[model samples]
Target chain A: MTKQVVILGGGTGGTLGANRLRRELPDDVHLTVVDQDDSHVYQPGLLFVPFGLAHPEDIVRSRRRQLHSGIDYRQESIDHVDLETQTVHLADGSTLAYDLLIVATGAVLTPEETPGLDGPGWMEKVFTFYSPEGAAALEGALASFREGRLVVNVVDMPIKCPVAPLEFCFLADWYFRERKVRADIDLVYVTPLDGAFTKPVASQRLAGLLQEKDIELVTEFNTGEVDGEAGRLVGYDEREVPFDLGVVIPLHSGADYVGRSPGLGDDLNFVPVDEHTLQSKAAPNVFAIGDATNVPASKAGSVTHFEGEVLVENVKRFLAGEDLDASYDGHANCFIETGFHKALLIDFNYETEPLPGHFPASVGMPLLKESRMNHLGKLMFQWFYWHALLPGRDIPGIGADMPSAGKQTETAH
Target chain B: MPTRTIAGATVDVNDEGFFTEPEQWNEDIATELAAESGIDELTPDHWKVLEFMRSEYFEKGTGPTVRVLGKTSGVTVKELYQLFPKGPAKMAAKIAGIPKPRGCI
Candidate 1:
């Protein structure tokens, strides 16, 4: 008997999961991947688009082209999933019944959720580099600006690429300096978090870098309204930060379809999964990964890549009626791009915060310290993302668990 | 972890004074924590939000974000700001004997 496996969203997690499952599962199991569109984007390149460092066309490819030969690809909008029925309903009134389901539709930006954010001055003075259109539009907006306070505000947390806004600030500092107008601009990074990042050691280090670059750090500002017409971000507490140009990372939530699905998602529509197993709490046969899950891990591509290894194995185990593997230790690593051709790498998981030292081992990439080598690694990741990561090929030496062998436990002086 | 005496009870607390051991939390301890944050008394409305936070944290292993709390906690966003001044999510979590909601790194 043939078993049906339906995977939602053709983005990073979905594509990787489908490809990996194709390789691991028996040929008797049929796989179908569904998404609204055919274009697969390299999301990391969105950050560089506003700086004119990368073009949109270079970062996008047809979704069908990336999938394996045997997998089925469908371009259709999702309506809802009936958990009890084990079915997915499409917007076109079609339905897919599956023996197993994987929800990978990642987080989406909701600028309209905040009052006045999508209103007047949007794409002119207020811009976001999170999307292809937003990033391309911001390039034009950033080019003409000469002076005044430019504010980069994160409306809230659990956003994809949590460090991108800070990366934008660093890149902007370098961009303006290259244009010799850096001294004329006051850069401010306003966030909902108490500091530059979630982890303590990394936050202190990144905060110091922001200070050295002369960017103002405003903590605990939960933006309630974006009065783009008046050029001010009003927080819920009524605290305000005025801006000449605003780069806002608006609120993020899981796919709207998830919310429409009954008994599947949380308040924000993110699938509640076992933190280690990636098995959906809603049902034993349903699983989730990446930004789609409320896993308390950074919603980054690297996390999705690490999760793919565990998720595929678990899916296989569940089908065999065997005990599922719970070895996923929330391992996530990211290269934080600072300006001036230097970047810092941080590697940590659920239990350990990012510490300073080498990554993978003592001889690997330096961790939590700025270096030109780390910057090069950031640039080279685009290639690895497309050629290696999306295909579910393992990056040798890096695995599902975070390595503690090379990291320094003692605080650095 | 550090120990602090709040409302005559010695409790384990983190650096930010949030209860490290949530089991040590009591209504009296919550009153003292709220008082430190400038809420003179725990009104019925305040307890609604506090109880919601504790239940969500113990069950989910995380405190709810302001957006989540506002949407599902039977508390309106506007009322949440009014009830727990400044940063409602962090402030309410502290008083509710839960660790502050964390941002993903």
Candidate 2:
């Protein structure tokens, strides 16, 4: 009897999970991946697209071609999940049953969540790099503008790669400097948080950088609406930020189908998951990963990569009639580019905050630290993403566990 | 705060160390690990490297190259070698707090 596995979303999470399963699972397992379109975008590269550092064509690859030989790729929107019947309904009125299910239908940006956000000035002056179209469009808009106030705002929390907005600001500064119009531009970073970042230590460090770059930092500003016609943003407290150009990371929500499914997800449509096991609270055989789950971790590519490793192991254990391993640490690592050939790296798992030290022990790369080497590593990751990451090959020494070798141990203070 | 036993290490839940919380890490054996070989404490020169490394990571989310570290810290490659006898990988690993470079094995 063949065990059928249906995976929703063919993005990074779904694609990697499927490839790993294909390599590890037996011939008796049937794997099918569902996505809306055939095109798979290298989401991280989207950040660099606006600055002309990366060509849009370089970041896009055919989804089907990336999958394993045996996996089935279906092009259709998921209408909803019938958890009771273990069936998935397609937008075309078709249905498929599976013994096991994986939800990787990453989050979506709702520009409409902010009142007047999608009004007259959207894409013309206000844009978001979260989408491929918005990134490409902003490139042209930014190129022609000689000078004015450029406000980069995060409408709400839990946006993918929280540091990306800051990266945009840094790159924008570098861009204008190169164009010899930097003096005419004013960069302002607006967030709902009290500081520039979530963690206090990181916030203080990042706040200083913002000052060094001459970028204004406005914290705790909860954006209520974007009055595009009026060319301004209105916060909940009625404070207005007038801007010549606004790049907004609007509110984020889980898959559209999640809202339609009853008792499966939260109010935000994110699946209620067992944070440790990556299993869905709705069904024992169902698992969730990436931006689809309500996990208390940054919704970044590294998180998805770490989750895929654990999910594959758990799936194999479940098939063997063994106890499921409840051991998934929310390990997330990211390489942030700070322009001028500098980048920083941080590694933290579920129980570990990002610590300052070298990565891969007292010998490899530095952690929670910056170096031009780190920038090179960031640029090099694109190659690794296409090869090692997507192909499911294990990079030695880089496991699911968070290491403690190089970190400065803090005894009870 | 969540506590779990990983490879005999009684990982503390409230510790602010890297991988210090249950929401961030899991218990998986490392595929390969490099041998440790570097200074444990922060020397004045090491502090120079450490401060620069931490600043860079916070700004960009990656580690620094020895050349950049050298240029920023005003240390020559030969001086860096004397300070970190085992080379950049070992020194970087010691600084990053990771087990070892994944490719080192």
Candidate 3:
């Protein structure tokens, strides 16, 4: 008997999961992947596009080409899932039945959710880098602007590449300095969080960098309206920040199809799953990964990579009638660009916060310290993303678990 | 692997134009590679980092990170960038004729 395995969303998580699973599953087990389009984005590369470091066209590739030869790729939107019948209803009047299901749909930016965000002046004075079109548009907006109250805002938490907003500010500082207009731009960073970052030690380091760069930091801003016409960000608590030009990281949520599938998703459409195993609490035959899961871990590409290792292994165990391994420790890493050709790398997991140390041990890049090495690492990642990562090939010495051999564990209050 | 004609000799290079095979490298190849990377010529300081990266890769099967280049090669990170505006670790490795170094990710 042939068993069907259907995976949703052919983004980073879905591509890796499908490729890794195709390699793991036997020939008889049918593998199928669903995505809305063929354009698969190298999302990490999107951060560089607005800064004019990369082009939008070069950062995109065919999603179908990323999958293994044996797997089936469907280019259609999902309508919903019949959980009891183990079937998926497609928006194009089609259906797919799976013995096993993997939801790697990830998250989407909902600009419309914020009042006046998608309203007038969206592409004029206000822009977002989360989407390709927005990023490309921002390139022009950033190039011609000399200086003013240039504001960068994070509408809420759990945004993709959480460090990007900060990176944009840093790169903006570098960009304007290169143009010899550094003093003219009053750079302000607005966030809902009380600190520059989530972790205490890291927040202190990042907030210090913000101060050193002379970029004003505004904390605890819960934005209620864009007020694009008035060029102000109106907060729920009645606080407003005026901006000459606004860069927004809007709210994020899982795919709409997840909402259509009753009991399968949260209010935000993210599937509730075991934080360790990633097995959906909704059903045993179902699993979720990447930004699609309502997990406590930061939604990051590295998080998906680390979780894929444990999740794939658990998927194998699930089919063999054995207990699923719940060993994922929520390992996630990010490179914080601090301009002037320097960046910082931070590696942490569910149990431990990001600490200062040499990652991967004695010879790896420095943690929480600015270095050109981390910037080079960030540049080289685009090649690695297309080759090693999406192909799901494991790198030597680097595993899912966060190595503690070289990390400095001195607690900081 | 792809091959590029450098200094009238074809040698293997990756898509990003970094040398994949180190044994086929020579002075002329280094000069040609330097020109392609936007550096006019390999200076004495450039040779120091290049030689160090080549030795490290051939001996340990790994190239030097920026920190390693700064600490061990006696060339400061800032100076390395001045010579190789593209990047220190990557441009030096390309000129050194070694595969891309690991641990950046």
Best by lDDT: 1
TM-scores, all models, native as reference? 0.97, 0.79, 0.79
Residue A355 CA displacement from its true place in model 1, Å: 1.5
Residue A144 local lDDT, model 2: 92
For model 2 the local lDDT of residue A155 reads: 82
Instruction: Indicate which candidate wins on TM-score.
Output: 1
Count of clashing residue pairs in every prediction: 0, 57, 0
Model 3: how far residue A266 lies from native, Å: 0.4
Worst 10 residues of 1 chain A by lDDT: A392-401
Report model 3's TM-score to 2 decimal places.
0.79
Candidate 1 CAPRI category: medium
Q: What's the CA error at residue A75 for candidate 2, in Å?
A: 1.0
Candidate 2 TM-score for chain A: 0.97
Off by over 4 Å in 1: B102-105
Q: Worst 10-residue stretch by lDDT in candidate 2 chain B?
A: B26-35
Model 3 chain A, poorest ten-residue lDDT window?
A404-413
